[model samples]
Target: MSAVAGKAAERVAQEVPAVQFRPKKIRTVAYASAALLVVVFAVVGWLLGDTPTGVIFRTSDQIAMALLGVVLAGAVLLLARPRVRADAEGVEVRNPVTSYKFAWADVLKVSFPDGAPWARLEFPEDEYVSIMAVQAVDREHAVAAVRALRELHKAATR
Candidate 1:
């Protein structure tokens, strides 16, 4: 390659910034709701009296109920786990229960369709990976993340 072309390529590579993205509104809501659920459940368990059939509610039963609430809160907190990391080399997308990593060559584009819940990384053969971290509820933040990822993909592929 020509010297100017090499310099331009180097510049482009240097311009690619590493980024980590996470849903703002969803994460905040998830944390708040989880905390609230745990508190409510624990309070109810502690104050629980007897059953309608006159069966007494034992301390063990109360403890078990509190534990159940903790478990449920943990499950609810999973909604905040989605994240995306991207750089010039590739991107990593982590949804609630699944994760995907793709090199620039494997990613054809970054798209956020109208009325979609989140952004996505397009691949060959019409395949794509959803990026839940960049959620529609985040609005401008999601748009900026998608644009940054697209720019990184372009620079890497070029």
Candidate 2:
């Protein structure tokens, strides 16, 4: 084989390692927002002394308000839960409310179309799995992840 051809073959032979992808900015924002919400709710609840109708706010009421804030914060944290894990064996996509696992053979391609919010794994029969972890907002990070995933898919399919 020619030297150039041999080097290209060697490059292809190098295995793509397992990787996990998650939205960076979104996760940071989610965590900060959750903390802020909890603190604000707790402070407001504690400062609640009397209602406009002369009804006094009890300790239990304060606790309940704080707890409500915690609950809301938990909901906000869900936005940070999306993740994608890929390896030689397969890929797993975990969206905010759903999860999917697919072997490399099952995925036809990794695609991020123009104006798409996130990447997706296309399959046979027009089905596809959205990869929320690789979001458009992440820009270069998302591009690299999709490229790595495509390389893995290419190698596995061969």
Candidate 3:
């Protein structure tokens, strides 16, 4: 590369600011899900133990129900976690199943286009990556996040 091109790339790489976004609703949902799981397990245990024809609940069964509640709550909490972090070098997206890192130069656009379930980055090879942290349920907050990402992308490219 030419000296001018290298210096320009260096400047772009150094000047872009870092930003992170995460959904606000996830915390509320996670807590509610955990509480609901516990309640459901307790109700089921009580109902089974109380019914005349139902098999008597053993102490071990109660313990198992408690464990099941805890496991379900943990799974719900895990599913709710999503985060996005972007800096001069690249953007890192963490969703429930996997995470991805994409350099600024490779991301052509950042958008939460109409009808899209979440924010997404338009990249090379006709690829689009989801930013699950910016959810549609959050509405305006999600829009603001997408705008911020677009600005960051433009700054890094320039």
Candidate 4:
């Protein structure tokens, strides 16, 4: 490349910041789901075990119920894992299968939903993106990311 062209390229590269990934940690969903599973298991166990007609339920049946309880608990814990990250360049929202990258300029809005396990973002194109991983497990982290992103946006503009 010519020296002038190379210098121009270097200048452009320096102007655009690099992306930094800050993963979202959402704990509430994970813990709450496990709790719900435990409650269900307890109710089922009581009905299946100590009831007066106990002979009908049997020990083997209880074991099967316990196994089901375990599976439910595991599911809840897995669902509670965080999946959101953000950095200097932009925000990255990830679900189990898909991930989207939005630069500070593209992010139009960030909304924290009440009684929901994820945060949603609206883009300039009018499409919606979910930062569910973080919302599911660490909402405070998600909020902090949004705040950080706002600052990043301001810096980029200036």
For every model shown, what is its TM-score relative to the native structure? 0.89, 0.87, 0.83, 0.53
* Model 1 misplacement above 4 A: 1-12, 50-53
Better of 1 and 3 by TM-score: 1
For this target, which candidate reaches the highest TM-score against the unseen true structure? 1
On residues 1-158, what C-alpha lDDT tens digit does candidate 2 reach at each position? 58965564455446677788999889999999999999999998988865577778899999999999999999999999999998766799999989999878789999998999999999899998899999999999999999988987887676
What RMSD does each model have against the real structure?
Answer: 3.3, 5.8, 2.9, 6.0
The predicted structure with the larger lDDT, 1 or 2, is 2
Arrange candidates, best TM-score first: 1, 2, 3, 4
lDDT of 1 by residue, 47-110 (tens): 8765577778999888888888899889989999999998766899999999988877788899
Candidate with maximal lDDT: 2
Better of 1 and 4 by TM-score: 1
Cα error, residue 60 of model 2, in Å, equals 1.4
Clashing pairs in 2: none
- Model 3 residue 52 lDDT? 79
- lDDT, candidates in the order shown: 0.87, 0.88, 0.82, 0.62
Question: Once superposed on the true structure, which residue ranges of model 2 sit more than 4 Å away at CA?
Answer: 1-14, 50-53
Model 3 local distance difference test score: 0.82
